[model samples]
Target: MIRINRRILAQGALALALAATGFAAAADTLKDIQARKKLLVAIDLSVPPFGMTDAAMQPQGSDVDVARALAKDMGVEMEIVQVSGPNRIPFLMTNKADIVISSFSVTPERAKVVLFSAPYSVNQLVVGAPKGVAIAKMDDLVGKRIAVVRGNLQDLELTKSAPKGATLVRYEDDATANTALIAGQVDAIATPSTTVQTLASRNPAKNLEIKFVVKVQPLAIGMRKSEVELAKWINGWVEKNAANGELNKIYSKWMGLQLPDMKKLADEARAIAL
Candidate 1:
């Protein structure tokens, strides 16, 4: 009799677990967002077009625009969080943030850690060298002192494929990297192509141009895997915005480009879905 009761209890527990998971899988993230009346979002204040503080020190950029539009659609307010690349995902998992609107690249390794929305934009990493020393390929970087921002994807990629004999110098921000390049501290600077383009716009230096030798990274929003509902909500929001061209308008106004065609990328992600 005891063994039978124990087995029954175990079966009941398993049934409840499956039922909960079934409900969780289809939960509407929008409903939770609306109930909160405000959604917490993380973004870097430094990266332009994606996220940045304006002259008035207000959050205003592509990331901000997208978040605001989504919040508006959900009928909620937004809580802008300033974050760095290193800790962005941690913040989401720890409930420090509900969503990440930073210029986040979607990678297989990253997807394993968290849920990612469809690609909303494309960001290419570019090389910037002093005048008379333009780099035509990755091979040209050999022996060149490279400057990069620490705690960023650029830093990771540079370390992974550093040119033979090249010395990698890392800084905390783009300003420092640009300054290092101008001061002759490093022979070249590498960063997201669009980010470098934004910096180049401010200084207008022939030496600070973004090179397209490297491939582009498709940018996406991030959420905790446990927050799959949030991911779907963001996906729906992106679909709605893209279908209406609001995403394009925001991209043109901030990043100075059209939204990337993410259908292929999305399908590819589906093939590798966790």
Candidate 2:
């Protein structure tokens, strides 16, 4: 009996030690960023207005500005890890990025894998085609070929909502999809409204126009599920920036529109959390 009791206590102690180690490991990301003086941010440069390169090939976009702001707020230098729609979460999960500031839309499916900060921006998933294509509703998508970035929210939502006889051509990323739309490889493309506008402005010959909106989604920062402390910090940062009009300014500068009501979105996010 005495030997058994000793063995049980030893096992309990070992278990407690392991739990403590795990807790520390999980909570250390914020501290690690501070200690290293660099915040590694993941972004997709292919997605213009949200993320893209300027004429000088330097990164310039709303998402890039937001990431820079976050790094500045944290008093750390920013290091951008370029990623695509499908690879953003993978990079975060693998520690290739500390956080993802790409146009990551919040959804129940994605919430299961990564922790999201309260929304800092909004995304309207829209279908865009030549002005001549008469697509005013979902049913009009029937018999149309739609292009979308594979494994993105646009792809998932379009897949769920598009009618039968619609063909979806999946591209590796937003840049490819936009290219296909311009090249007339697809009849329409499902992407963010801002992206559609950017494509239209850049390629007037395509005569691209928004056909209809599929969904309005809130965009948030994405971090690994274990990085609760880091997520909390980012959420606080978003709230602070939102209140000060900084986020709105960034949105207006790149997107040419006012930001959505972040306070309302934050409340909604809290309700979701509860």
Candidate 3:
């Protein structure tokens, strides 16, 4: 027979408590948000067009608008949780934010940790450089210094595709990476096409242009993987907004391009997953 010692009982009780805490942390985020009457959204303010502060230092960008729309539709107030590209997931997982709307590109690896709603936007990754640079292909990246926002999709994709001689310099955020490219700290930059456009418009003398298209990634809202109810609600919201053209208007306002067919893209994404 075995004795029921206090030490063993205490250890087992602690384990159960920890498991319960984990489950509570990940449970029914939609209900929690509704009860609190607020939605905490993670956004990277340094990424222009997607998330940025205007001259008045008030947050204003595509992602910000989207988050605000989501909160408005849900009958809740929005609280922006400013984050960097590398910490978006951490913030969501730690319950620092209810969801992430920060130009988050969906990937298989990321899906393992977070649940993504139907895509609401698309981002085209590209290699950009001054017009004087003769980079027409990935091979041209050889012996070049490339700047990328650390832990972003651009950084991950470029890490896999860049040639052996190419050197990648990681920065903490998109704004810093953009500055590095403009200041000649790096020969090229791996970033979204929107960044290239913003750079050209702001720094006309830099002559920055896209050298080659890297990848077209679908952007979606991200939440903790266990937030099934929240994911379902977000997916429905995206579909409804897409049909009503609200999403398109937001996209065009910041991206200067018509939004792609989100339904078609979502179907393609589902097919790829299967």
> Which candidate achieves the best TM-score against the true structure?
3
Against the true structure, what is each candidate's TM-score?
A: 0.81, 0.89, 0.90
Query: 129-193 in candidate 2: lDDT tens per residue?
Result: 99998899989987888897867877777767677778778778898889889988889999999
TM-score, model 2 to reference: 0.89
> lDDT of each model, Cα atoms only?
0.69, 0.82, 0.83
Give stretches of model 1 more than 4 Å off.
1-32, 173-175, 268-274
Candidate 3 wrongly placed segments (more than 4 Å): 1-24, 271-274
| lDDT, candidate 3, 1-274, per-residue tens | 1211222221222233233335445589899999999999999998889999989999999999999999999999999999988778777776788999999888765765677889999888999999998899998987788888766787667667777777778787788889999999889889989989889889999998999999988898988878899999999999999999999999999998998878888976565333
Residues 66-175 of candidate 1: C-alpha lDDT, one tens digit per residue: 88887788789998977766667656655667788888877655666667888776667777775577577777877677787754666656666655666667676666
Clashing pairs in 3: none
Q: Please give the range of 10 consecutive residues that has the lowest summed lDDT in model 1.
A: 1-10
List candidate 2 segments past 4 Å from native: 1-27, 270-274
Order the candidates by lDDT, highest first.
Answer: 3, 2, 1
- Best of the two (1, 2) by lDDT: 2
Sorted by TM-score (best first), the order is: 3, 2, 1
